[model samples]
Target: MAQRILVIGRSPGVILDAAERLRGKGFRADATNQFDDVLTDYDTATVDVVVFGGMVPPDSKRQLRDEISKVNGHVTFVQGLAGIAGLIVAQVESVTSAAGDDTGVEYDAAERTVRLTLRQPAQVVVEAWWATSFTPPEPASTSTRVVDSRFDPGEHVVPLPAEVPAVASFVTVSVGPAVHTFTVGAMPDAVRRMASTSALPPVRAVATHTYG
Candidate 1:
């Protein structure tokens, strides 16, 4: 069966455009301009994913999310869309394929590298920022790095700044449109012990969140 996708937008024309584009890409697609109608249709239709168009208000999207969660938790939610048709299709594909895999930052205490793993191939980019405060101090130094090349499905580790203070408290990993955060706590010491080991450190499972 074709994947069922629901697109909600403020403009009826734009919603219809995206729905048609998705349908051309082989998805069973539908579009709507009203949030209330979406909830009404949910009971009558089986949806695999719901994407909020760029014009949809953030608050309305949140409301739709809450209401949808009550109806079906397995359905994936995506947003932060661009008007470009190809990019929108790619975004949907990436999010849908990323299910059931690790998609976050893992610290390698010994090598001082942050390993990011994704379930599918993508041009992955990551940002590792650190500071003494759990909230991270203002003007905290943030280092952004991109993988030297597109990563195939699996793990890729990028080295962090050697100057990173032991007091570093947080790290955020971004893979395509998905982002995941981790609290530092005792990661520094853990990395040190890992560095001393002759065996490779086991890949740690990390949870990821999507933002629009």
Candidate 2:
């Protein structure tokens, strides 16, 4: 079976373009611009990776990340801008095993370029172990009030109720030398509210199941 991937963002053109590129590379790619649509579709499809566009609201991005981590332990989440740049390099390096080639670097910001490096399989194992051990605080049941609704782009904000519940889920993954973490709540409404606010980029949210 082909590996499944989900791409979400406000820019369908960009998302679809990336999806096509991934499909050409042999992965099964599906792209959507709506977060709710993606969430519904994820329930019915098998997804292995999620590529998010840069425009996703901060709140929604967190919820989507949480959902993806919960549904697919091994699923990789790549950011549309910075994350994509890094991921493409990583993927290329992984596939080609090309070493010490500075020719692949492409500048985005003045200080950053696409750095592709090989990832060891053992890193995945370590990540799995770390995820299993780490725990997150439960999401609040009541909606937490925010001082201001307006936020700078790319900011991550957690809007939990003042009184947080005791149940929460967290996932951790290691990509190269860095470890990334995601947190989700038991109540879907809490996550949905966050995703809907300006905090998250405008994109459809989806959750996919894996069949062993």
Candidate 3:
């Protein structure tokens, strides 16, 4: 069974949205705008993780942590996270892993190179498919590159294809059991533009012999 997570935020809608996303990630999620509502129906034992949104009050958060700890010592508390959808997913995964599961994974990018990090030495599999839009095509039309290898408990670099088009938004990079979809544009916008601009070479004149 998936762990139950409670999301507390200033905005009800945002909390609900985050809950929905977390639910899709194999977690039983519930959201509430009011801090008091989190402990209303669900006991501390039922909620495995309590995720505080970016806009949550600091004082209230601290007070609530102390209050909840008295009820359930095993509940995990996470706070001060970005509101972006993708970022929220990453933060939740990180916090939950810290509470227990050590098989956590994260990735970073430098130009066309991707660095994947694992909390422990585990079997890591990465599959990528490039496209202009997020909507994946039929299995028949889609092409995926799978790299199955064992990486130590550290960062490992994975190079992307150089032929990816500028119109491509992102490549689907699936690591372990989780999948992260984002654009791996060859480089940053400014750097890519600078590399694209071509300069003409200086032309040499052979008129020096006429003066002699």
Best by lDDT: 1
Q: Give the lowest summed-lDDT range of ten residues in model 1.
A: 203-212
In the range 1-212, model 1's lDDT, one tens digit per residue, is 77877776544444565677778867777776665566765552357888875545556777888888876767888772333333345556656554444565577766667787667786665444443321111112233343436778887778766555555334445565554544443334533343234453232221111110
How do the predictions measure up, each by TM-score?
Answer: 0.45, 0.42, 0.51
Off by over 4 Å in 3: 97-114, 117-174, 178-212
> Residue-wise lDDT of candidate 2 within 1-212, one digit each (tens)?
77776766554444555566766766666666666556655642356666665456676778888876776677667653212222332332243232332222121222211122322222221111101111111111122222222223331323323243323322222333333333332323443344345554333333322222
- Give the per-residue lDDT digits (tens) of candidate 3, residues 1-212: 78777777654445656777887888877766555544554566657788776445556677778878888878888762333343455556755643343444343445555567667765555544433222111101122454577777877777655554444224444444455545443323432232123442222211111101
Worst 10 residues of 3 by lDDT: 203-212
Which one is best on TM-score?
3
Separate clash counts for every candidate: 3, 21, 1
> Relative to the unseen true structure, what is the Cα RMSD of model 2?
16.8
